[model samples]
Target: MRLRSLLFAPGDRPERFEKALASGADAVILDLEDSVAPLNKPKARENVHEFVLHHAGETALLIRINPLTSPEFEDDLAALSGLHPFAIVLPKAEGAASVLKLAGSLASAIPILPIATETPSAIFEIGSYRDVSTSLCGLTWGAEDLPAAMGATTARRTDGRYTPPYELARSLTLFAAHAAAVPAIDTVYPDFRDLNGLRAYVGRARRDGFSGQMAIHPSQVEVINHAFTPDASEIAWAEKVAAAFAARPDAGVIQLDGRMLDLPHLKLAIRILDVAGR
Candidate 1:
């Protein structure tokens, strides 16, 4: 799957499910955790179950279940029985242990995308994701939940940039995903109305090696997709680097455009080509 943009839709709002899929996100996350009220969770799960039954494999569909510690987690699994989403999005995931816990609970083996840094303890366990990387589709983190768990006032500064601690969380998630050889998915940009700000955010994310980003609103989907997609210049450069290495198969280092390039450059070029679907 491309996974350039994964939009979240409330599981209870089945009316908007089709709308979300039509919004051009690579995937739609049917959220049964934070978005649905406690009293509405059962109904939400039913809605998600019904939707998944009809629409499974129609698109990249991910269902964000409640945390492993929550009582609703079992019900979430129960509702998803005999159904397969593209992946299961696990919130407040601590590490490999959490991934294994969810994996063991499921009747079938399903890919997981864990929200890796929602609690203070999760930060220390970031590196542990490499152990259960095979069970994951990607790694993502949230700034909003971590601050609330820490009793903080906010995760970001007045300028809408992440504070130092939250920045650490984001960086850890990014590096951990790379360490596991999985795509690092950036968390949702909360200010859905700020298109310019979202564009800048996507630039920083792409620069920092996040292959994709989460979207809370439909308007952000096109922006994320356009920004994350490799442009003509990038594709040309990557092709040149790839062709240079291809010609000198035995050479670990080669000259490309008068600059010395190495195996890492070739690997990156291959990744670019893969992302571009070339």
Candidate 2:
């Protein structure tokens, strides 16, 4: 699946659901966490339930349910049990045990995409996700909740880079996803009005091995998609590397341009070509 952009829409506002689906995002996540007020969770859960029932198989849709620690989590799961969305986005997930428990409760093969970083302890347990890799749709992180949990004033520095602690969280999320063999989706850019900044953010994310980015607005979708997609230059480079490897099938090493290329570089070239469907 092409998950270059996963857009989020508030679950309580069903009016925006169809519009989000039409926004050209690879996935539309109906979010019931943080965005919806405490009093509004029940209504939001129902909205998500009905929306999934009508549109489950039509698109790559997922539900961002309340955290397992939240009171509404069970209700959220029960509401969607009849016919689950393509995947479930479990927020504030600390480790593999919570994911496995959810899978056991659902008793289905539907994938789970965990927001792998949200609490202080979550930082230590990032690597444990490898145990539940089979049911994982992707592994992503969030910065907003972590600062609140840690009593930090902000998660970002003055220059917009994440603060040191959150930076560590981001790195662990990236590593965990790769270790689990799933897409590493970066957190939302949060500034929908700044297209140039958004572009730079997604560019950095793709370069760092993150395969997708979460979008808060439709305006961010195109930029996210373009940034993650291997461009013509990248495609050409990947093709050249692949062809070089093909010609020297029996050789264990090769040289490309002025650099030494070997098994790892060849593997990366193949992955790039595969992502481009080339």
Candidate 3:
């Protein structure tokens, strides 16, 4: 369940399926929307079905199906019936209602991961995800589609940082995920070749409480995994904080390293340890 990196592969490309599984990502998302052309969707669906049959239980394999509003949505669901995937990645999701709708369409109940922000209305519905969060594995956002929907030239500034509006979308998605008690996955860094830039991007995402990031390319997987994994120094600090609180079991506050350690600090320490798999 360590979703530090979810790598995407086109659904029609059965040849690359094994390669994506070998890329060291925590999960692989076989995409049926946006990546594959309309005419190729049937073949892609068959490819996904066959791939899942062969490797369903081996790793965390998810399918990014067409949006609920798309004409192809029902066919996507029909094609995936009777098969189990780690989760379904719902793109262009408006809110909890959308999650429930997809859940109802599935032959069996499976966890969902929604790209919560892709359209203008979707931004306003971010907070509604808490309603169906228990059924979600994570919540992610996208920068590309939203800008296109709004007719904006770009989502990012010349510096590669998101513009104000898109930054709002990103922040809302992060908060919504936490509010719903699910992992907040950062969107992909489209320029996959820019390792240095991707590193900096992952740092900011991790610093802001995002638990994972999407990887569009195999090379980005390593960087995402490394950035999200709790390091030795962090683990040590969490252990020390936890030990201090454990010794003062009844105390709401304790002094440690000339600082006042309180309940919130202990909570954060516990979370850090959990993330470190202690």
Clashing pairs in 1: none
Candidate 1 weakest lDDT stretch, 10 residues: 255-264
Better of 1 and 3 by TM-score: 3
Q: lDDT (0-100) at residue 68 of candidate 3?
A: 99
* Residue-by-residue lDDT tens digits, candidate 1, 10-95: 99899999999999999999999998999999999999999999999787999999999998888998999989899999999999
Cα lDDT tens digits, model 2, 1-278, are 88999999998899999999999999999999888998898899889888999898876999998888778878887887787688999998988988988888784678999998998888888999999999899999999999998899999988789988899999999999999999999999999999999988899999899999999999999999999988899889999999998999997799889988998988888889999999
Off by over 4 Å in 1: none
- The numbered model that scores best in TM-score is 3
Candidate 3 off by > 4 Å = none
Q: Model 2: residues >4 Å from true position, as ranges?
A: none
Measured against the true structure, the TM-scores of the candidates, in listed sequence, are: 0.97, 0.97, 0.98
| Rank order (by TM-score, best first) | 3, 1, 2
- Identify the superior model by lDDT, candidate 1 or candidate 2: 1
> Scored by CA lDDT, what does every candidate get?
0.94, 0.91, 0.95
What are the per-residue Cα lDDT tens digits for candidate 3 across 1-278?
78999999999999999999999999999999999999999999999999998899886999999999999999999889878999999999999989999998888989999999999999988999999988899999999999999999999999999999999999999999999999999999999999999999999999999999999999999999999988999999899999988898999999998999899999988988998889
Q: Residue 210 error for model 3, in Å?
A: 0.4
Task: Look at candidate 2 and give me any clashing residue pairs.
Answer: none
